[model samples]
Target: MTDAARDLISKAMVDAGDPVEFAAYAPSNIALSKYWGKRDRSRNLPLNSSLSISLAEWGSHTEVAPSESGIDQVSLNGEVLDMGTAFASKALKFADLFRAGRAQPLKITTRNTIPTAAGLASSASGFAALTRALCGSFSLSLSEAEMSLIARLGSGSATRSIWHGFVRWDKGRAEDGSDSFATPLDVTWPDFRIAIIPVDVGPKSHSSRDGMNHTVDTSPLFAAWPDQAEADCDFIEAMVREQNFTALGQRAEANALAMHATMQAARPAITYLTQDSWAILERLWAARKNGLEAYATMDAGANVKLIFEAQSQDDVTTLFPEAQVIVPFAG
Candidate 1:
């Protein structure tokens, strides 16, 4: 959890006499493209646009409950959090929406499905669940776009979780980040499953947050993220219109890794690319290297998720038998 929210949740606890508990969920996903470096840092808005699909099989779930008497309480997979402070931090971001005219406090509790130190995007799922649970508990019915804005205040990548299938995160032109919300794409999910294989490399070398920060502060390629992100967005629109699996597969694989390339050129020239990460990529490349059309994409961390037709499940399973494949059930 972000420290600013953690502190606020703690303060809310002292003032509120009561708090309740409820369950929330944060689903895992692979960025077919990527969501990186924020344009508006305070709001955690992105510098470039991105597209992704929510992975139904490999994600996180959280629980948030607030009492009728006072503030709320939170727990993730059974561990209680400083609900008041957490909620207060989140609540503050949207003071206009929740408070209406004055200041108020809230409590939030959450848990993550991804490994704590690994590069998998638990924050995206975590923030997504937080937004959903908080909106429900507060009796506030925010539209998907509105919810995405709230999620952005929590984390930039989180904005994508507002939808189930194909989604886009746009980098708006406003300082307030009103334009930086997620829009759903046309890829129907549950038909496609993701294989998330984390290469064990003594844990992630650097966190996505730190990596993105490095990209923004130092990398010369950072200048290209926004323009290229918009181009990727255009490619996505075409992907949906054509539904060409081959184009979709190839475009996504290259774009995702390209988004991460900035970190490689950062100040210290550090990279999270380990042997296992490349091993998976190598296998994917080998498949494409042969004639079997398969594509893969990754997030900020070290995991490689293979994207292929459900019909090819057996073949994928056979090729990467060691990887954890999540076959989505039709929803």
Candidate 2:
């Protein structure tokens, strides 16, 4: 946490108007299928549908207690925040949105437990956790739907962190954005422990927020996104119900490719893949080509996370022996 974040959190603690302190951990999510598009920007509503798997080993921890003053602050990594950039992050945006003008400054403190930016959804978890914590501090009786809505304002995919395991963000029928909450399906934490070692956690080659925004405004392919997304969502739901790994992986691969497809169709295109990225991809392909059951998926970042049974950890590691592997476990 930075000094600014600390200051923000400190003020939140003492604020006469906002006295409650709230804390929560936001877990990292990997899209078996991704969410793209926007119904509303400030509300963080989606235009297209997407689904993801929440990882137990990675995410963020957040605490938002009462503020003493009329001020809010943020602190990260033991550094007092001198930069205002963190405020510009989606976390603050969602915090303010949920406050709904009764907003008091929260001294928000946060720490990342997962590999951020290395194709991990740490930001999604971070913002979602912040929104949940701030909302808690407000004495707000937030329903999961409302909380998901609040989290959405922080990041489109974040809505999933509110749940524990396999989550599906329903692109429901409300234009007011009330029906956008994610629904958790069956998930057993011990069954899904796949080690997700990160390759890089700095600036991603392409930002998800930016990519989704571009897909909405500039991509010709955006026309058909909603239909495809809805279908993928349904497919994933059934797969989870049946615990069908093949169906789940198939949907995941299609969803990931579709999310990437829009990036290529954007006005000025971009891809997060580096030589490191492709090398990992090629390795996964070679493994699969040789009749191995191994597979991998990516978001708008370069880290290539392998999807394998917890029991296959040793085998998966040996196959892509050089790359980091996250043994998947149920949430």
Any runs in candidate 2 off by more than 4 Å, and if so which? 1-17, 88-92, 98-103, 116-121, 193-199, 322-331
Q: What is the lDDT of candidate 2?
A: 0.67
Reference-based lDDT, each prediction: 0.67, 0.67
Q: For residues 213-241, what per-residue lDDT tens digits would candidate 1 score against the true structure?
A: 87889998778777877787679658855
The window of 10 residues in a row where model 1 has the poorest summed lDDT is 1-10
Q: 120 in model 1: Cα distance from truth in Å?
A: 2.3
User: What is the lDDT for 120 in model 1?
Assistant: 69
User: What TM-score, computed on C-alpha atoms, does each candidate reach?
Assistant: 0.81, 0.85
Model 1: runs farther than 4 Å from truth? 1-22, 67-73, 81-119
Evaluate candidate 2 by giving its C-alpha RMSD to the native, one decimal: 5.8
Task: Report per-prediction Cα RMSD to one decimal.
Answer: 5.7, 5.8
